[model samples]
Structure formats: C-alpha cells, structure tokens
Target: MPLFIRSVRLYPVNDNETFHRRFSVNVAVLGSLNLDVVFHCEALPIPGQTLLCDDFATGPGGKGLNQAVAARRAGAETSLLGAVGADASGDALLSFLKREDILTHGVVTLADAPTGVAHIVVDRDGENSIIVASGANRAVPADRLATAGLQALVWLAQLEMDIEVVGGFLREGRQAGARTILNAAPAIEAARSLFGDADLIIVNEHELAQFSGVPCPAGNDAAIEQAARKLMVRDDQILIVTLGAKGTQLVDSRSSFHVAAAPVVAVDTTGAGDCFCGVLAASLAQGASVPDAVRRANIAAGIAVGRTGAAPAMPLKDEIEAVSNG
Candidate 1:
C-alpha cells in the first residue's frame, strides 16, 4: 500500500496562525509524567565508585509529557493521559503542561503514590544515562481514555507505563477509528503484543533488535530492514527504526526507505526521540504522507538535540518549517 500526502488549505490569518492551522492535527498521548533531576558530569560513575557532577537541575519531564509538548508545539491539538502523584512536583508538572497548552483532563493525580522521577546524568558528548522510578506513572489505569473524552485522529503511547494500560489505549484508539502509534521505548518483552495493534511503531536500533530478535547494528541497513519487516502485522503497517545520527529507516510490507538526519551539533540528546515521535504523529494526523512526516520529524529532532532538556528542547512548528525550507 502506498502512502500519499493529503491536500492542505491555507486559512486567511496571521502568518503564524495560518501556518499552525495548516498543520492543525488532533493527537492524544497516553504515557508517563515525571520530574527530572539532572546531573551534568564529565563521565558516568561505575558501580561502587563515587562521581562528582559539574551542575544539577530539576524540571518537568516524562515520555508522555515530552511528547505532548512536542505535538502541541508542532501545531497539534494535543491531549495527555497519564498519572501523577498528589505532590508539589505533580502540581508543577501540571502547570507546565497547561502553559504549553496541552489538555490535561486525562492526567490523574493519585494520593497513594509519589510522582515519577528520572535521575539523568549527561556527559560532555551529550549522551545520557537515566534511571526512572515508576511511582505514580504505574498507577495509571487502562480505562483512562474512556473518561479522557479525547477525540483525536492520532493516538500515541510509550512504554513508560504499564504494558496492559498502553495496550488498552491502543486497542481503544483502533476501535475508535484513530490511527494508533506505539513508541516502544525501554523495550519490554510484553510490548510485543502491541505490534499488531499499532498502525505505526517507532523504535531505536536496540529496541528493534529486542522486538525482532535480530541484530540491528547502526550502519547495517539490510539488517535493519529485515528486522523492521518482521514487526509488520499488516500490509499497511509501518515500522520506523530511529538510527540516531545515521537518520531513520521506514519499512512496510510494500516498500522501505531511509531518511537522513539533519546535520547539527548536539548539546543534549535528551527527548530527541520523543520529539521525533510527537512531530511524526502530528504530521500524520494532519494528513501528511508517511515520508513527509518522517522528514519533518527528523528536522525537528535535529533542532531539539542542539538544545538541552526534554520537553523544553522541542522546536516550534515554524522553526521546523524554516529548517526544512532552508
């Protein structure tokens, strides 16, 4: 099956408004919300060794929150469905989402659990090591979508939450005639059950190897394609393998293609994948073809890596357009 771009109408408004409406897509994100505690270090510590960091900071983060921000910044009507602890961290996270104009009615506050937290250490090369505490993120129920009242053309989810909960969300989205996407990050054995339910599946090289049981090295295009094809559940189902600096590879039953990443000096790689996933979902919701969506996402992610933080590093719609046109 071939994918084609949909026709877009330019509205009579300000330049920014017009551009926004041109790609105004409705997207729902169901995943986790966490407060990130970051340590800037020269190098990560080994076991039983103590390491000192140059600086430290804390901010709102989580795959769900980051992706929601990315989609909204990319000009999508985005809604987030997840859980947070009934703490100040949760309140601040909620406030941050509101400031980003993301719908938060689906995000529940739980009393018994603490807000999820991620301890991240970034080195000079922009690579990071992270350890996450599931906390309230694991408390999100499977029925959140029913009460969320979110009407979307694209439903996006990640594995930061329970597998059953994410699976339920994807199944319900499919039943509601929405295109479901699963970003199989932090790859788990149970996530394999979702490959058939999602219309689009996004993963990195390591995740591709985990899911497909194939060795997907960074530069091996043939091995990557072979692994990607094994994850296809339907003729039209598309699987995207993010190759970091090498760009991304797209595979479906009918064909496969590769898109190169935009050249940029990265200061922090955090949230680059989330930006890609969110922008990709937004583009698809707005009826962009698969190839165009991947290209736009690649450009947006390039911009994100040049900055710091996760959600805050996401590029605006016009920024991505400018880079694309340049």
Candidate 2:
C-alpha cells in the first residue's frame, strides 16, 4: 500500500524570524551534533602531497544538527533531540539552534565528553572527503531518548549517533503513531537491522549498496530498481535512493519512479544529502505525497549544493518554491 498522501502549500515568510510559528507540522531529529572544520583545496591531496586553497571555515554540522536545521528552514516546527558537550562548542550549538527557532529543549549537555568534530576537505569541484571524531556524540544516553517528549508528527533518525539508540527511538516513535523516516548515512552495516522500523528509508547510492549488500547500479535506473526490490521486506516501506546530480529513485511495492534533479552550479556538497532527508521528512509531516515531497526535496538539495556549509546552506521553503516555479 502507498503511504499517506496530502496536499501541503509552501509557507510565505519574509525572513527567518517567522519560521517558528509559521508551520503547522512538527518534526524531531534524533542523531549527532558536531563542529565541522572545512578546508578547500584545488584538488584532493595525494599521499605525501599537500595542497592549499584560500577557503577555510568552521560551522555547526553532523547529520542530526544539519537535518534539524534543514527541517526548520523548510517550514516545520522542528526540535533537535541529541547530546552535546558541556563546553563552549555545545553552548554555541545550542545558541545557533535557538536562533533558528528550533526547539532546544530536547538537546542535553554532557559533562564528561568533548563535543564531536569533523574534518572536511572540499575539492574545487565541490566533492568532499570527511573524517569524523565521534566525541560527545557517542555519549548520548538511551535514557535521554526515552525521557524526551517526542510529540511530533514525524521523527527523523540518522547514523551519526549510536545505531542502537537510533533504533530505539524509531521503535518508540512508531509505537506513538508518529511516522518514522530513517536516513542511513555513513553506510553502517548495522543499519540493515533497523530497516523494518522505518516507514520510509532515505539513502544515497553507496548507502543503499551497503545496507542491501548489493552492488549499486552504475547510471542504470532499471538495475537500481531491481537492487532496491531485494531490500524491501515489507509492503509499506518506501525506499529512496539519492543519486546526486542524477536525481533520486523511489521504490515501493505498489510502484517505483524517478525524480529528476534540479539544475544548479555546484559549490559544496557537504550536506546536500542531509538537506534532502530533512525536507522530505518535513514535507511528509505536512501530508505531502512521496513524489511531491521528493521533488521539493530535490529542489531544496540542489539549492544547497550551490552554496557552502551544511546548516547555513539549507534553503527555506520560499527559496525552494521560487526555483520550483521558475
């Protein structure tokens, strides 16, 4: 059977000031928070080789933080449910989330651990390679998730935090009658066990390959569909495989289709995938059909890749509509 589908209109806002009260749908993100240290280079360094470029920046990131910000910017009543260090980095992250009007009540501070961090290298073509240091992110207590009041209509989960913790949230969220969406990033083998808990699963080509243990198709939609079919154990579960500039493939037991990517010049691809997942969850919470939500998310992610940074790069609902209408 197809998932629930409803028509949702875009919000009209002059600026970020109106995001909090503008949308009716509520969403909660359960994952990790990190400080991203980014470096730009002419080309990726070879072994024993060093290259330098002018751009260097640091900003708030991690799958959880980025997705929460993206959902909020896309006009959802968003809350971030995760842990941060008790130091300055955690304080700064909380301030940023509050400034965006996303609820920080679910975010906790841990005294014993340092904040998580990521070192990212962006090449001239907007391609990136990242290495993460899972600091305070790994310290998220399972009890915290159990205690948080996740009254939202939708709950989004990712792999940046402990996989078991994320699974627990997904199970609990489903029991509460809230729709659950899982974005399986960083390609962990354990994600395979949690697929049954999600009403929808969003992943890139690589993640799809990793989860299914099936080789990803190379530029062939038919082959991708075949591979996706092998991973669908339940009739209700929807699978979305993001194909970068090539767009995405949507798979369900009833039907499968492709959504084309929006045209845009690329600058940084750091959180483009995260932008897609966030907007999709927010759109679904507002009752959008799978195809409509995926189309809007494609546009939002295209806009994000044309800019830099993760959370800061996410496009608001109006921005997505502008490009979508044009």
Give model 2 RMSD, 1 decimal: 7.1
Alpha carbon lDDT of each predicted model = 0.87, 0.84
Q: Write the per-residue lDDT of candidate 2 for residues 141-208, one digit (tens) a residue.
A: 78654223346789899988888898999998899789999898888887788889999988888878
Model 2: lDDT equals 0.84
Q: Local error of candidate 2 at 124, Å?
A: 0.5
Q: Mind giving the per-residue lDDT tens digits that candidate 1 earns over 1-326? A: 22323234444333223321222238989988999998888877788988897689899899999999999999888888899999999999999999999877678788899999999988888999899998999975665333233457899999999988998899888987899999999899888998889999999999999988989998898899999998887888999999989999998887788899978898989889999999999898878998999999999999999998998999999999999998
Position 194, candidate 2: lDDT: 86
Provide the RMSD of all predictions against the true structure, rounded to 1 decimal.
7.5, 7.1
Residue 57, model 1, lDDT:
88
